[model samples]
Target: MQYKLPVSVLVVIYTLDFEVLLLERADHPGSWQSVTGSQDEGESLRETAVREVFEETGLDANHYGLVDWQVQNIYEIYAKWQHRYAPGTRHNTEHVFGLELPCVLPVQLSPREHLSYKWLPWQEAAGLVFSPSNREAILQLPAREKARG
Candidate 1:
């Protein structure tokens, strides 16, 4: 079995007005979050962000403004998911990114990865995520955007 890397990326997909895109997990019903996935060997963090966004939402990150927030969050891996990592891997470091779309377009979700998708206000999206790191990233969306401007 192939173990996943301890590094990953969390991508916040949003519009100019702060409507963030979130996905309901197929594995954990009712658990919603932004695009996220483990980084593949030899892939850059930015590449991981773009690939995860496409895999989760079917949105091509290349066409949008994909920004690396340059922020990293280290957290304990969920007990249920720790098996996917190598033995003794108890933590993960997630790099944050933002993909700004012009509007809220319909997305084609990978059925195996997500059950559904929603576009909500940043505040609402932040509240819906299960992971604290993901929530914090969504909560900072407005401030990040303002800083980008």
Candidate 2:
């Protein structure tokens, strides 16, 4: 069946030192964000996160520190992006995750989905992302890390 659930995962790819990785959206050149994608049928949120990270950035989620913040955000779908979903879909559920690597690692971007990638400090990454929820997730990283510690 064509999966129509607006559920998805957002992985904030960062380093142990808090350098976050952001990717430019191919469809919207200046728009940048962490690894994100819709979930497929029968896939758990964590599984979706791992698959999307590899699909979008070639990073093995298992090799790094992959943590599910256990945070979920439900937001109204942007008018411009609503076309990608089924008709009358007004909202989406996003599960937030954090993938911490040792350092800025090489990326293999899906050219059709992203134009480029950048590694930046947490503050800068938070500011650069277009989505408010994504920015909020980035901003929460430090506190999340600290709490985990």
| Top-TM-score structure, candidate number | 1
**Superposition-based RMSD of candidate 2 using all C-alpha atoms, in angstroms:** 1.3
lDDT of 2: 0.92
**Per-residue C-alpha lDDT of model 2 across residues 1-149, encoded as one tens digit per residue:** 25357999999999888999999999999999999999998998989999999999988898878988889999998888787788888999999998989888999999999999999999999999999999999999889889889
Candidate 1 ranges with C-alpha deviation above 4 Å: none
lDDT of 1 by residue, 8-100 (tens): 999999999999999999999999999999999999998998889888888899999998988999999999999999999999999999899
Deviation from native of the Cα of residue 51 in model 1, angstroms: 1.0
Query: Residue 143 of candidate 1: its Cα lDDT?
Result: 81
- For each candidate in the order shown, give its overall lDDT on alpha carbons: 0.92, 0.92
lDDT of 1: 0.92
Look at candidate 2 and tell me the lDDT of residue 76. Answer: 94
